[model samples]
Target: MSEIGITCTGAAVVNAIFNATGRRVRDLPITLHKLL
Candidate 1:
C-alpha cells in the first residue's frame, strides 16, 4: 500500500497546472510545450 496516495499527488499537480494555465494535460511528464 505504499502507492495508495500516488494518484492523489498526480491529480493535485495536474489540477494546479490547470488552475494556473487553463490547460488540461492528459499525458505524463508535463513539458513546456504542453503548457504553451
Candidate 2:
C-alpha cells in the first residue's frame, strides 16, 4: 500500500542524507538542526 512507498522513500532519503553528511537521523520531520 501507500505505507510501503512512504517507508521506503523515507529510508532512501535518510540514507542519502547519511551518506552525504555522515549523520544518522532516527526521527520524523527531519529539520536542519538535526543534521548539525
How much lDDT does each candidate structure score? 0.90, 0.91
Quick one: best lDDT, which candidate? 2
Q: Can you write out model 1's per-residue Cα lDDT over 8-35, one digit (the tens) per residue?
A: 8888999999999899999878999988
TM-score of each: 0.76, 0.79
lDDT of 1 at 22: 95
Per-candidate count of clashing residue pairs (backbone under 3 Å): 0, 0
Q: 1-36 in candidate 2: lDDT tens per residue?
A: 988898799889999999999999999779999999
Q: Once model 2 is optimally superposed onto the true structure by TM-score, how far is the C-alpha of residue 27 displaced, in angstroms?
A: 0.5
